[model samples]
Target: MRLSPSLFYTTNCEPALAFYEQCGLGRATILLRWGDNNMPVRTETMRAKIMHARFEGPGVLFHASDNDDAEPMKGSAMMLEFDDLGRMRRPFTRMSEGGRVTVPLARQVWGTSFGMLVDAFGVQWMFSCSNE
Candidate 1:
């Protein structure tokens, strides 16, 4: 069995998707739109909303969709562990652009690089890299 964590966006998912891209995450393709398949758009907000999108990066994969209720995003946190410090640092710094840094990336006494932040979408993220 496999598991994929999905993120729920607050209304428009554009900002969240752009944030991920700036963090070095790969592009996302809209699998479905709220206005697709001749489905009726109940509200103007739904017309251009994404019903589903798949995001793929070097070693990342997740799905996201807009939270129709437009409520605050209080989703789960995600962690990315890497064998290369450079790869780990790139995204960490980019994610910090509009995100809240809980912990800046630094070499720990244990010989590992680690950091944490909450993205603009309110999703917490943890990044780590090995000394090797």
Candidate 2:
């Protein structure tokens, strides 16, 4: 079975899809907004919203969608682990260039490099490079 990490955004599902695609993820699929699937969405405004998206990056599957209820936990964050630190330096740095850094990328007591940030949007994200 194939398993992927799924994330729920506040209401920026489309924008998030575009961002993830730019972040090396493949084309995402929207399950709800098709021509005729007939999976009644509660709100009409959400018709254009993304109900689900699947992306394959670095041999892993990542999923995303929008949380229409406005609940706090509906929109969660991610802490991505990378094996190639060299390949990550650029993207990680670029993601943090104009974002707020909750924790600078540095070696932790656990012997790995980790950092946290909240992007231009209010979404929180984390990145880590294993020292192994």
Candidate 3:
């Protein structure tokens, strides 16, 4: 089975989507707005809110949505493994903007270049690539 993680943004899905795109993930697709569907409640104010979105690329596939009650996850992290150290730089730089770096990119004893950071959207990410 193929597993795709879903990310729920409390209110900033647009920026989050853009941020991921900048990190080398493909553009958002299959966008669904809240008011586009027939619901019994008033959704005019939420018409611009993203009810669903999909982001897919060479090494990523995930769903995203704007949620009012969504809370950021703190302990867990999303780790991305790259084929080589060169492939890890650009995305690492882009994803680290305005974010706190818990572990700077460097050569690890395991013979890999690795780094960790919490993105501006409060998402934790670990980037790694084999040095071999």
Candidate 4:
């Protein structure tokens, strides 16, 4: 079985998508916009909203969509493990834009470079790279 997380952004999916891409996450492989025959509810107001989108990066694959409920995103995080610190820097910096860093990227007692932050879209993330 394969498990993939789906991120729901009430009205800000487009910007969120762009943000992830800037953070070195791959571009959306598939993007479906709300249309006439897709959703059960009225599509007029949501025509511009994203019905679904998939992005794939080195060790991550997630779906993102726009929802009407506007639920708050909390208590979940995407952890990224990298073998090289140099390869992880750009993404770490980009993901921190306009967001608060809960843990600055630094060497940990566990012998890894680690950090945690919330992205501009409220997605929590943990980045780690081994010292080796």
Candidate 5:
């Protein structure tokens, strides 16, 4: 069995997908849409919305969708750990832009560089890179 966290986008989910790509995290592959796959036609507003999608990254995976029925996300943060400095630093810098940083990237007691921030879309993230 496997478990994966699901994210609901506030908008059409396109912006969040773009952000993920910009961070080099992953791409959102649209699996299903309201107006496709023989699914019953939803409202005009939802026709273009993502009904189901998958975000796959290096050891990261999650489900995402955009619809009125989705609940707003809060009180949780996505954590990513990497052994490579270049891989971790790029995302930490990109995702922190236009977002509030709760913790700056610095050496931590755990012997790793750690940081936390809330992205522009209000999604929180935590990053840690092992010190070599």
Candidate 6:
């Protein structure tokens, strides 16, 4: 099968959706905070916290939610393998501009030039180019 939506759980769904929208993803569909018949108990606080959201852009559907407010998940990285380095470089640089770079884009041990960047929102991404 092909790619579907990728979901992330956040404590603040509204802000997260706004961030993604700023990143060029379009409007997100937020789950009803109240008045929806399918809501779970004790989840009224999250009625506005994005029970679920959908963002469509760049040919993929991206989803996220404010499902949990406990502790932040750590060491989670998302790898976006690109076929066109030309198309990817700009967006990748923009997203990681104010963030951290764990590995600068350069020839790597795996025979590819790859870089690791953590975006402003703390999402880690690995960008790479295979021998072509």
Please say which candidate is ahead in lDDT: 4 or 6: 4
lDDT, candidate 1, 14-78, per-residue tens: 77887788778777865567788886676777776777889888888889887577555455578
Residue 44, candidate 2: C-alpha displacement in angstroms: 1.3
Query: What lDDT score belongs to each candidate, Candidate 1 first?
Result: 0.79, 0.66, 0.83, 0.85, 0.81, 0.63
Q: Candidates' TM-scores?
A: 0.85, 0.74, 0.89, 0.89, 0.86, 0.67
Cα RMSD of predicted structure 5:
1.9
Candidate 3 — which residues are off by over 4 angstroms? 39-45
Who is ahead in TM-score, 4 or 5? Answer: 4
lDDT of 5 by residue, 14-107 (tens): 7787888888998876567778867765577787677788999778899988776666667888999889777778889899888888999888
* Candidate 6 accuracy as lDDT: 0.63
Put down candidate 4 lDDT per residue, 12-131, tens digits, no spaces.
Answer: 898998888887787888888887355544456678688889988767799998888767678888889999899888899989989989999999998899999998888889999985
Candidates in descending TM-score order: 4, 3, 5, 1, 2, 6
Clashes of each: 0, 0, 0, 0, 0, 1
Please identify which of the two predictions, 1 or 4, would achieve the higher lDDT against the true structure.
4
Q: What tens digits encode model 2's per-residue C-alpha lDDT throughout 1-132?
A: 865677666677677666656666355654455223775676876776777667565555777777677444325566678786776566667666556888887778998888887765456778888954
Clashing pairs in 1: none
Task: State how far residue 48 of model 2 sits from its true place (Å).
Answer: 1.8
Residue 6 in candidate 5, Cα distance off native in Å: 0.6
Which lDDT tens digits does candidate 3 get at residues 1-132? 998888888778878888888878678977887767663223454567888899888878889888877898667888899887887888898899999899999999888899999999988899988854
Cα RMSD of all models vs. native, in order, equals 2.1, 3.1, 1.9, 1.8, 1.9, 3.4
**RMSD to native, candidate 2:** 3.1
Clashes of 2: 0
Clashing pairs in 4: none
In terms of lDDT, the poorest run of 10 residues in model 3 is 38-47
- What's the ranking of the predictions by lDDT, best on top? 4, 3, 5, 1, 2, 6
